[model samples]
Target: MHAITIPEPGGPEALVWAEVPDPVLAEGEVLVEVAASAVNRADLLQRQGYYDPPRGASPYPGLECSGRIAALGPGVAGWSVGDEVCALLSGGGYAEKVAVPAGQLLPLPEGVDAVTAAGLPEVACTVWSNVFMIAHLRPGDTLLVHGGASGIGTMAIQLAKAAGARVAVTAGSAEKLERCRELGADILINYHEQDFVQELRRATDGAGADVILDIIGAKYLDRNVKALAVNGRLAIIGLQGGIKGELNLNALLSKRGAVTATSLRARPEAEKASIVAAVREHVWPLVAAGRVRPVVDRTVPMRDAAEAHRAMEAGGHVGKILLVP
Candidate 1:
């Protein structure tokens, strides 16, 4: 199988396309002939030797893919050969063939193609787990999202709105903020010029946001706490800023706010399976009904993953970047 492998970690240029041993399916896994993969910020970190795949995971950069089942491992059921599916992979999505846990597989949402479906897993799981499962965003709650133009951001805005939450987002530019607004964001903040804490408070009439989804970790830590309403929940999913920062405990305590963090890639198979199931039951219906959709900014060939990484680094894309395999 042809794969994009980092022989030795360096930069996007380190992603070398070469023939490698085909992945073998394990118990409760399925062999997927990958149709497409999508780029995430974490892929860049993995390529640069910062993020290592968990034990027994594929040593490739991709975290999600859309493909067909070429074969199934022992105990697999409710699916068969040639089933069209998109799956959240531990890694190895950069390859033509990846062995994915059957439990993590989801049927391509109605009206979506393989390439577009490739962009679904990471964002879907990230938004569902963080916004719904962790923060418990309910109808009428005010939800704030950082990196509102990102793949996760777009998906989060849509999901939160569909669930009846009032969505607010922060991005770097007016164009990106407009895009978020189009996706149902009620309040938009240009982070480059506006203070998110102040804007969020003003947007909510000094009540602050009920739930805040953050990607810039250390840089936003203090202000995020200050921007929370009473009993608000802050879920940090990325550290685009520095990882270490001081937090004002007094602010959190005063607001009775809670802070939590997680990475989808680091979860156990069973945990991921549960999230997938929940997404299938709840989120998949929204996509099927066209109330939500994958936001793809561009599509690049699998061999041009280096270009995708470069594009993401340049920060010009408004949504997900797909890699056709």
Candidate 2:
């Protein structure tokens, strides 16, 4: 087997595709022959030595992939060898083959092919867990998403709108904002030129956002609190803006707001299974009905993962980038 390995964390150049030993299947796990995997911001961080894969996880950098089952491990049932599936992985999606927990596997949504399905798992689970499950965003509420052109941002916009919420997004460029609009975002703010807090308040008649999905963690924390409506929920899933920031407890108390931060890669298997189950039940239907779709910017060959990482860091893509093996 061959996988992307980082002998020394540095840059995109550090992602070296090389031969490695095949993964041994543990009980309740399955071996998947990777068709494709999606690049994520976390992958970049891992390459730079800022983020490490959880204990016992694959050293590779990918968190989601689409592939066919090659074999099933002990105690695995209901799924069979040769099943076409997409899975939420803890790590190792960059490889030609990966071992996945049975609970993390999902049947490819109807009408979606293997290559594109590679882009779905991480964004779907991240957005669904943060926006719908944790924040409990409901119909008629206004939800705001930062980095609106990103994989998670694009997914969040469509899912919130599909659930009957008014969706708002902050992107860095006009082109990205236009794409967000095409995905059902009701309000689009060019963060490079405008204040999202002001723009969102004006868009909602000064009512503010009922829920905010944020990736720019510490840098946006104070402003995010200011942008929230009373009793609002803010879910932080990434810390691209740095990890340390001060919180104004008085402001939060006055608004009765809540802030939560989580990482899908670090979650326990049972918790991930629960989230995956909910996504299959709730999100797959929307996808199958053509209400939501995977937004892929482009696909790069697996051997050129370094190029994919460069593209992500350039911040020019409007959606997910797939690495096909």
Q: What TM-score would each prediction reach against the true structure?
A: 0.99, 0.99
Per-residue alpha-carbon lDDT of model 1 for 1-325, expressed as tens digits?
A: 9999999998789999999999987899999999999999999999999999999999987999998999989999999999999999889999999999999999999999988999999999999999999999999999999999999999999999899999999998989989999999999899889998888888889999999999999998999899899999999999999899998888889999999999999999999999999999999999999999999999999999999999999998998999987
- Tens digits of per-residue lDDT for model 2, 44-137: 9999999999999999989999999999999999999999999999999999999999999999999999999999999999999989899999
Q: Among all windows of ten consecutive residues in candidate 1, which has the lowest summed lDDT?
A: 196-205
Instruction: Judge candidate 2 at residue 42 and give its lDDT.
Output: 91
Runs in model 1 deviating more than 4 A are: none
In model 2, which regions exceed 4 Å deviation? none
- What's the lDDT for residue 205 in model 1? 91
For candidate 1, what is the total of clashing residue pairs?
0
The positional error of residue 183 in candidate 1, measured at the CA in angstroms, is 0.7
Report how far residue 82 has shifted in candidate 1, in Å. Answer: 0.9
